[model samples]
Target: MTDQFDEDTGDYPLVMPGPLWKRFKQTLADFVLLLVNKCKSSYVFDQRLMDGVIQLLTGLADSQVRAFRHTSTFIAMKLSSALVDVAFGVGGSESKEYKT
Candidate 1:
């Protein structure tokens, strides 16, 4: 069996997404979301890592590619929830690492 899509799936040969599906484009948003979700604790108490996050997202916004812009925007939206969690310290007391 070939790696290509099977007729059972009914997915036609894709042409629209040829350029859109650049290397790691699909994983970019998910990776950022995972990072932001897991980093809430550090974000609440640290400035350096957060600064890097801000700078990275800002620089990604400077790209003219649709994939970069779209992924960055989606990551930014999801990141807001993480920021809110950090703002209210939602997981601090629940986190074992922060336990006294």
Candidate 2:
């Protein structure tokens, strides 16, 4: 499958549809890396970043048309918990918490 990245925002857009499993794996990996970097750096977590994460998770949750509701519910639960942990500074792993 081909990947599409937005030139202006450097955001990867799901231009082509693919298998649910593949999309889920890729999205999860991308999110994990982003979270790790964000936690390690002194970067301020802004609304845009949060929005993008939410959107990505939502897409992953709704990837399967047959079980959209169930997938979305599960994803929502995980996302909520993750957000809480991040807010409380307990989500990032020790190794990923500091970059320097």
Candidate 3:
């Protein structure tokens, strides 16, 4: 995810990830949310990681893989919720560029 970041725009490329990427993304999101839940303050300072997680959530939520509809939906909700907390953790300092 971070590899796809556009330095000029500070946004990820709008492209559908590969099939194998689905599991990798899901696992990473799960781990990220777990870490955020356990150590709320530890991740807020890593803006790049936060940016990737947000991008990951958006991608997974928008995916049309059709293999794990329920699971994807559930994880999306969890990630979205964790993101809200992360946003507050940073005092919502995320720049407009990152939001796109």
* Candidates 1 and 2 compared by TM-score, better number: 1
lDDT of candidate 1 vs native?
Answer: 0.58
Where is the poorest 10-residue window by lDDT in model 2?
Answer: 1-10
Q: Which ten-residue region of model 3 has the weakest summed lDDT?
A: 7-16
Report the error of model 2 at residue 99, Å.
27
lDDT-based ranking? 3, 1, 2
Candidate 1 lDDT score at position 34: 70
lDDT of 3 by residue, 1-100 (tens): 3234332342221223766666666676777588777766666457887678667656755655433333356666766677788777566666654787
lDDT winner between candidates 1 and 2: 1
- Tell me the TM-score of model 3: 0.39
lDDT of 2 by residue, 1-100 (tens): 1124222332222333458666875585457545645663343266666677678667755553424434455556655655566655654465566754
RMSD of each: 10.9, 11.2, 13.7
Overall local distance difference test of candidate 2: 0.53
Candidate 2 lDDT for residue 77: 64
Candidate 2 residue spans exceeding 4 A from truth: 1-44, 56-66, 90-100
Clash number for model 3?
0
What are the lDDT scores of the predictions, listed in order?
A: 0.58, 0.53, 0.59
Kindly list the per-residue Cα lDDT of model 1 for residues 5-99, writing each as its tens digit: 23234332221246555434546556665776776556635888877877887776666554455555666776776577665566665685667
